[model samples]
Every structure is written in structure tokens, then in C-alpha cells.
Target: MSTEQPQSGDPTGMAGPVTDDARLFPPLQGRAVPVAQDRWERLVSAVDIPQPPEAVWAALTDPGRVAHWFGVCRGNWARADCEVMLDFEDGEFFWCRIQQNSAPTADHPGRLRYLWRWVGIGPVTSVTWTVAASEGGTSVTVVEEAVNPPSDWRSWNGMGWPGILDQLAAHLRTGTTWRWPWRRMGPYLQVPLPAPPFQAWEALTAPGAVRHWLQPCAGSLAVDDEMTVVMGDASGCALLKVTRLVDSGQEFPSYLPYLEFELRRPRWPAPLAGRIWIEPVGLHESLLQVFQSGWEGVGIPAAVVERRILTGYWTSAAARAQMLLRPPGAQAPPIGPHGWSLSGGDDG
Candidate 1:
């Protein structure tokens, strides 16, 4: 199902702050509490699907059907200790070994358990899919637990399950699955700078200096302030809300100074977040790192093209900034995802 909302005003326009009222999914529910004295952490979420247990069981076990909603399952569930490979078409294939596959009986529900791990990776985790008869049809629950949880485990994985379950519910009710393999598109670039870290930081944060490399931008880029970035010839503009402006000489002197902003556009599915920071290399050299995430906007083919254009713009922008800082007669660096180039691209 399409999640894109209708656009108003210019397609490349300003955006409002993201609020709970604009969220597409329900309030996230789940826990990341440690189990067994901090040895392992669990993420769990449940949804009541308006379908029979038998249908839900087939969707969970059938390889072809599972591929429709989740990843491509390539093994027989009926076989004892079956080894399965779940390929989500994202360059990585997850290897799973079935630990339990109890079919639904007259008195009880069904439970599918497996040991999940990346190929050649250690510390495999456990994943369980349960389906039971509920008031209307079936209640499906998913649990995944692993050791050494990351710092954002609660907000990332724990809250993410509800959205996946929502997708599952949509698939069962209307036979419509979202765009397959919703790839995450976060482009990262690092450019070697001829100047020191402070100079490079000024080229990034100073609105007047930024005009030479990127589009003409005018606004106080302080924390909690907003900046207006004008497109070519002032065709359109976008707003960037400065979320952070960390200085190296601040209280946290050990931390690298960085500027983080929330990019807003009228037609975007969600606001994208980006950051620019300086890394000192030597007495007179530094590296400028630019990274932006939240590119998967749920509109597959169009989103893919949009992402490439956006990435190209950022890449070219960094290249321009590097050129502005480079000394005359300096040879150009290699052209790659991380290198500098002067080719221009449009941005929203």
C-alpha cells in the first residue's frame, strides 16, 4: 500500500516538524528488558490478524507465501532440523536452523522457532513466531532475543516490530504487501581537506561560505534554529532544522565537533537527518565527513531514483567544497563513492 501523502505547494518545499499526529502506524509497543540477569535482551510485539489460524500458519510456513511478505524462505519446514536461508535481497542472506515447528492442534496453537544468524557469524539468536486463535481470528506474536543488545535496541528493533506487524495485517486483510526489500539508503562520504579542521568546519557551518560549494543558504545555523537552502536560480527551497551544533572546544572537548540537521521537504515521506563533522588528520590536514540517512521513503522505483539524485547532489556538493579548499595545481583525487568530483546534481 502506498504511504505517500498528497503534496501541497511546490514539490520541493518546506516541511513541518514530525509529530505523533502524522505518524502512519500506531504507538509502538514492545520491551527490551534483559532476560536472565542481563545476559540476553528480548524484543516482542503482537498483532491480531483478521484471518484464521490455518491461513496465518500457511503464511508463516509456506516458502512462496513467506517471500510475499517477509524474506525469501528456501527450505522445507516439514523436514526435521531443516536449514533455511532467508534472503531479503539486501546483499546479505540470513541462515536459520529450525529448532521447533509445532503445528496447530485441536487444543493448542502452533509455534515456529528458529536459530537465526548471518552466515559465518557467531552468537546466533533465537526467533519465534506464534499463532493462536483469538476472539476474531488469530493473534500472531513475534519474539526475537539476543545477547549484547545495542544502545538503541529499544527504539530501533523493539518499536520496529509494530510496523512490521502492521504490514503483516495489511497483507492478510487485502492481499497487498509493501514494496519488496525496502532497502535502507544512507549515503556516507569523506573528503580529504587541505585546511585544518576548524576551517573545514567553517566551510560547512557558515552560511556564506556554504554558498560557494552547496546551494545559497542563509540562516543562523545555531542549535534549534532553521535554515533555508535555496535551489538553483531560487527555483525552490527546503528547510533544515539544526538539531545539534557541537563545538570541539565545548564541555565535551574529546568529542568531534559536528552539526546535525533535520532536512524537511513537502513531499518527503519523512524528514531526513544529516550531519557534517570534521576529523583532524595532522597539523594542517583534516577529513570532512558527510552522512545522511532516512532515504527509504516507501515509494520504490520513484524513491530509488530520488535517492540516487539526492546522493549525487551531496557527493557533488562535497567535491565542490573540497575544490574550494584545495591549493592550485593539486591533482584531483580518485573518483568513487568516497572521493571528490565536480559533477553537479540537483537536490531538494
Candidate 2:
């Protein structure tokens, strides 16, 4: 991964030793994190494939060849105004409508444009793929732009860009594919709390209790209520409505006393949903589990939902509640998304 300078007459920006801009643009170290900007954020990565742009373009737009490097692409790119679904190796899926397919010719590079979205009906976020002939190879770039960027835009695409472009490079070089690994690790938490299930429910549904750990509370949380949760680190928010509240343990299936929520945001085409189920295990103790479902929906971007933020927001909130339920001067356990600890007096 040594950096090289661009040679004279080189159209491919891939030639030079990558500069600081490479981290954001492309040809970056695989581990570099995406940097954020006001109103928008950019993630750029480039690779020098020893083939011409035409070959790269074929691999990119060809449905059969795409799954080799990217995800499983469905639909006919050759068909005008075709709709495509990119089911990623990680089980995340994207719905895309082709707007322009500027095929590559011997005299000109190829340009393909699409209206990409999390669901069949959400924001028309732009995703453009460009391929150009370079000094010794082809230069390819994947650009995604959200006009009204979601709060977790950086988390959704920024952190995962390098690996994506890397897979494309490997595909060109050795025909390799990628499988998303977080499916087994995301948005799931099991932490025993020192407080009873009722007390934990109060913190979760109380008007402003979520603000302490998750985000600033907006609106109310009555059963069948609708509210907004704002991000503390960014200006984005998720709009949600509590659709059901089951409080009868006797009649409730599996010790029922759970809550269901349907999430939405203006401009997004699909719905996101979540649930929380509580189970008591001991006197003044409870087993708290937070389940963030509805990811199977195309409306919510996999990047936005398949994270600790959506998955762990409540887990972290549960941690905060554990702190609140304990007496003053009690210490907080060093629990994590996958860590486990009993609900008891401070062991420290």
C-alpha cells in the first residue's frame, strides 16, 4: 500500500502517493474513519486496478459479475429505467433506480448514475459510479450524497467505505467477494440490572428519561404515543410512534409487558420499528433485553440501523438506568454490547 506520485499526462488520480485528501476521497488506509462536515459528509476511496475502465465498468454494472466484488445485484442494468436491488453480503439491501447509464466506449470512459435508497420509497439519495482510464490502470470512485443527510450518515457509510472499495479492488485483482459480519453482533444486548423490571420500564417510557443516555427526548411516550429522539452527537433524529403496549403478565405470552414502536422520518420512503421486552429474574432485579427489529425493511438504511446506535442506544440506556436504580455513590459496571454481569451490589 505504498503511495506513489502521479506521472505527467495521467488522468487517473490514482497515480500519486495519496495525500491527506486520500483518506476522504480514496486510496486510503483501510482503517481510516470517515470525517464529517457541516450539512454533508464525504467518503472517498480509490484503487488502481490493472485493467481498463471498460473491464471495470463491466464488472460494476453487470448483474452476474457484481456479486463477485460487491453485493448480489438484481435487475437488468442494460434495460432502460430499470429497478435494481443490491442485497449486500451482510444481509443489508438497497433499492436503486437507474437514471443514467453512460456506457463506456473506446474513446470515452463510462458513467452510471442511479437514485439509490434504503427502501423502495425514501429519500432520493444520489449514488454515482465513475470510471476513467489512468496512467497504468483504471480509477473508480463510489460517491453517495444525501441532501438532507441523516444524523448517522457518517456512521452508516463513512466507517464502512474502505472495506467496500477494497473488495472491489480484490474482485478486479483476484475475484473475491465480501460478507458483512455485524449481522451476528449488532443491536442486541443482554445486561442484568440491579433494579426490578417495572422500574426499568419507567425509565424507558418516562417522558424524558431516555435523554440521560440515548438522546434528548422529544414529545411524549404514552402507550400508542408518537415521539422523536434526537442524537446528542449530531443534528439528526428518528420519528417514532408507540403502536402497542402489553402490560398484562398473566395474559401476556412469555411473561408479556413489552412495548412496540414504529419509526419514521420525513423524506424517508420506508418505516423503521423497535421493541423492548422485560423479564424479572430475582428480587429487585431484572433481565433487560432490547430488540431493534424492522431492519428487514428497505426504508431504513442498513448502515443507519445495523449499528450500536440503534441497537445499543437502549442497551446503553439500560446501563444508565442501572446506574439510576442503584443507591447514590454506587458504581457502574463496565458492561458492553456483548458483555454480561449480574445485578448485585458493587463488586468493585
Candidate 3:
């Protein structure tokens, strides 16, 4: 009796494709060509609930009820190859087609995996939902895999899963729906600076200084042949080892540059690897930008934490610069919108 649409495709709410060319960028070079024959890319998101698997399964299968939790459900809710519309209250919608759905088997119960191809997009995205009955309740896992999406798509999707999963968990807990109505955390941060000058201001490149500013706890630092800084933090630390360093002099994009790191701790939530860019505004001033994706485990929104950490890093860097130039008793000036501060030494 639930109003939720069935996991299978339905026909009543079907609509034409919504194609917006501006939002879809041209495919990256070699993206159309299969990168590998056995390329099996997957992104996994999971949440623990204190509810039974059957309850979660009902929510997953009911179209009208699912709409309450995610968004408005339109289209036939009972067949494959049917268009599914997720219409938001803000008058926005994403069009997807069901590609595959697998029922629970002996090894797995209450598991559903389906392919979702967005209208006008190049690649079809695969989403897998698995429910396991545990001692307390059920643990639900959602995995999404996109094929050769642009960098922007990957970045946005990376930060988006946590919020969505959070809503899913809340719905399961209270039998009510939840929606994320805020802007993504990444675009809100604006760090302006040129690449070359920023690279020159790499005072933190030194192992001693990196340990002092970035890594508070015990860790090792190493620079690779490409001049990337590799760092590891204390045990059970969420922060991964810093792997790459770029000179601001390079003609990179105005956004955060790509970074590579090796994760030692397993418990650190999503965002296993990505890039970070730092721009030096002045001799002692710099702006930091981070673009990361991928999660090792579930829980805790990584994008929110990354933004907070980046803000702190910038603030600390400014303070460090002031301390280096100014003498004792000299007051530090306020950081400007562009991340620069006074560079004169105090005469106290």
C-alpha cells in the first residue's frame, strides 16, 4: 500500500529527455575509447540502520514513497529501459534510464543494482543498493559507477554522495524523507593566486616546516623525483599522506590542481585521493584549493571536513608568514580577501 514507486519501471510519469548541452562537456580525449577491457570502476556508499531489511526493501521498491525521500517520482515504475525522473522542489530534475536490476540471492538478500543513464550524458552510471540484516538492524550500501565522466562531474559526484546517503539513512530511521538543499562546499571556496609565484612560496616544502604546519602528530615526509611531497600522519589519523606538490608557475586551471596520495589509514571516510592547488598572492601570502574524490569507508562527510581543514591551513599559513617577517610585539594584520597580509617587520 506504500505510495513509493516500484523498483521496476512504470509508464504513467514518463517524459521526454531533458538535454542541456551546456552542462555536458565534450568527452575528454581517449574517454570514449574504453580505457581497458576489464575496467570495472565502482564507487560505494553505505549507512547503518536499526531497521529490518524488509522495511528498507519496501522503501526501495515503492515509487511514491521513494519520491518522498529522494524527490518526485515520475514515469512507469515497473519495467527496465524506462525513463525515471527525479524532480526536485527547486524545479530541477535529472533523467535516468534503468539498465539492470538484480534481486537478492543466496549470498545476498535485499540487494539491487541498476544502471542509470542520464539524459544527454555520454556514459551510463551504475548504482547498486545492498541491504544486509545485522545483529541490530540492516546495513544499506549504495555504489555508483560512472564511465569516463569529466573532471567536474567526478568532483561534484564525489562530494555529493555523503549528503545523499545521510538523507537515505534518516529516511530509513524515521520513515520520513530528507533533502539536501544547499550548495556544494567546493564551489563556495574561492582561492585566487598565480601558479608560479605560489610555487616559489613553498616554505612548507621543508620536512621540518611541513611537520610543523601540516602534520601536528608524528609522520614522515619524502619528496619524489617529480618534486611531490609525500607525508604520513599519526596512527588512525583521517588525513592521508600528502603526495604531490606543484609550482604555482605552471599554467594550470584557476581551480584546485589534481593531487595524488597514498592512504595508510582505512577508517578515513570517502575522498581517498584527488588534487590540491596552492597559489601565492605575495612573497609570504598564498591561497589553498583542494579537489579530492573517492572514499575508503563510509560515514562522516569528507568534503565538509576538507573545506574546514583547508581554511585552517590558509589561516595558519598567513600567521606563519607574519611571524617570519615581523619582530616581537608587532601585531599581525588581517588577512585580505585575496589571502595577503602585511609583510613588514615590527620595530618594537
Candidate 4:
């Protein structure tokens, strides 16, 4: 069934208590709350299908059928202690151990519970899928909980469901799933920060943060403020407009705060955009990153020159910014999200 909206028997709001400690550093909707005792986050959402319970159950349990919806499911469903694999097209996959599974019945319905995990993004998240027969169709609920997952992961997994459920419903009605996997390619940089992320956050968003790390510039740039950055380097002087400010938005507001800007490149036509992502690595340290993409707008792509610019400028500058933000004796944190090449890929 398609993920339509709130239906009867659906979870109308968040489950679990919003404990007192959780209120201190409030979580963005469907986001992780690290300040609280439980470092993990919880997300609950539901989808309605026009088919009956057994159809939904079949679409879920049958390996060949499930493959058309999301990831391909492998392993024997008949074995109670079997290990199932969910492999996507890009070779990225997750392994899950079936915690519980009930075949759909006339009186009640059915449910499936599994513990899931993947590489790059670590942390085991318990996932639960419940299906019940309703008046005209079936209602399905999906719940995921992970302890201290990477901020982007929490957000990515949470936001990626409805579309998947869409694929499920489509595969049930038609024959094939609609979407595939892809990753953005670009010169990316990550810099370490001092203890306590909030303190590191100040260094990222404080007035002139971009100018401090990026280039010497004109315009009054500051946090909670928007301005233009005018700078020059080997590539020549260019202007960038801070298009939007999201203090702590997306998957990891606390761990990853953001500042977005649009590059005004008149010569190269495609829209050039950049993002400054601040990610807290541990309670004592954080990582700052810079990324640029949208090279498809250009006739002659100078990605090598761009990589030199990113590493030569931002990488070195981010190191300097780290010193500026950290205490004198504190060790400099490492940089990464490694394997990002100056040489381009199709993901621009």
C-alpha cells in the first residue's frame, strides 16, 4: 500500500516519553536526542495499502516479490532462526536477523521484527513492521530505533521510507520498482573540532566563520545572517551568496549543523552549490566538512583545479580554523569521509 496519510489504527504521534533531560537539548522532529540518557533515536510512520492483509504479507515475505519493492530479501522465511540479507543495487546491503514473524490471519493480522545494520553508517537499529486488515485495505506501520546513529543516517533512513513504501505498492500493482541508488560526487573536506559540539558549533556559525576558513572577503557575514562572500584564488575572484541558514536542521542538527550557499558562476552554467556541515564525532570532538557539486552545468569541467582549490584553500583553512576554535593544548582532530576524489564521477 502507498504511504498516504494518517489512518485509523495508525500511530498518530511519537511513542515513548519526552523525558526531562530530552527537553534540555530538544530534538528536531524525528531526530536523534543524544543529550538524553538514550543516545539512539526513534521514528514511526505508517502507510496504507489498497490490498488485503495477505497481499501485503506476500509482498513482504516472498523473496522475489520483496526484491521488486525495496532490497532483495534472501534466506528461508520458514526458518525461525534464519538470517536475512537485504541487498540493494549499488552493492550496499544490510543484514537483519528476524526477531519475529507472523503470517497474516483472518482474525488479527501479522507483524515482522528485525535488527538491522549496514556499513559506512554504523549502529544497529531495530525495525518493526506491523500489518493489519482494515475496512477496505491494509494498514502498515514502520518503526525504527537506533542508538547514536550518524546524524545523516538517522535522517536519511527516516526520510527514505515513504518513497520505498511507494515502490512496494507499485511493485504489487505493476511489475518493477521505480527508484535506484546513487551517491553525490565532489571534492569533500572534513576538519576536526574541539570538545563539546555546541562550542564547536559556535566556531562554524559565528560571524565571519566562512571568511575565516574560506577566503578573505567583503560583506558582513555572520550566523543568523545572510551575506555574500567575495574572494580570489588561482581560479579568479568569485562571489557566493549565502542562500539559506539552517542552524541545526536535517538528520543531525546537534551533530551536524549546516550553512548553504549558491555559487554565482556566470561562465559555467549549471547551478554551483556548497554546504558547510559540522558533525560532532564524540562528546569531546567534532568534524567540519565542505562540499561542492553541480558540475553538470559546465562545458569544460575543471574538477582537478577545483579539488586543488578545495584542499589547498578549505582544507588548510579548516585546519587553521580548528586551531582558532580549540584550546591551546587540545590535539587537532583528523579530517575525512575519505575516498572523495578531485577526479569527478557521474554523481554531480
Best by TM-score: 4
TM-score of 3: 0.40
Which runs in model 3 stand beyond 4 Å of their true positions?
A: 1-41, 102-107, 119-122, 182-250, 253-348
- Candidate 1 error regions (>4 Å): 1-39, 77-80, 118-123, 158-160, 177-181, 186-348
Sort the predicted structures by TM-score, highest score first.
4, 1, 2, 3
Clashes of each: 0, 17, 33, 3
Point out the worst 10-residue segment of candidate 2 by lDDT: 339-348
RMSD of 1: 23.4
Clashes of 2: 17
Q: In model 4, which runs have C-alpha deviations exceeding 4 angstroms?
A: 1-37, 74-79, 152-154, 158-160, 177-348
lDDT tens per residue, model 4, 1-348: 867565455576332244555777665667755663335678777888889998888888888787777776666642356776675543235667788888779887788888865521224678888889887899888888865555565456646467667777787777775445443344455445655556777765565665555454555444323344322333554456666666654445253467777655445455567887666665676666666666555444564454444434444555556666768777655534321211111111
Model 3 deviation from the true structure expressed as Cα RMSD, one decimal place: 24.6
lDDT of each: 0.65, 0.59, 0.48, 0.60
Better of 1 and 3 by lDDT: 1
lDDT of 1 by residue, 1-348 (tens): 977765596464335534444665555787465333234578889999888999988877887777777777666653449877775544234568888888776689899999865421323668888889999899999998875433234574546488777767877788875534555645555556777777777666666656556654566677887767643222355577789888866646556688888876556657778887777654466667666777664334466544544555555666677777878888755455322235422121
- Work out the TM-score per prediction: 0.45, 0.44, 0.40, 0.46
RMSD of each: 23.4, 24.9, 24.6, 19.3
Count: clashes, candidate 3: 33
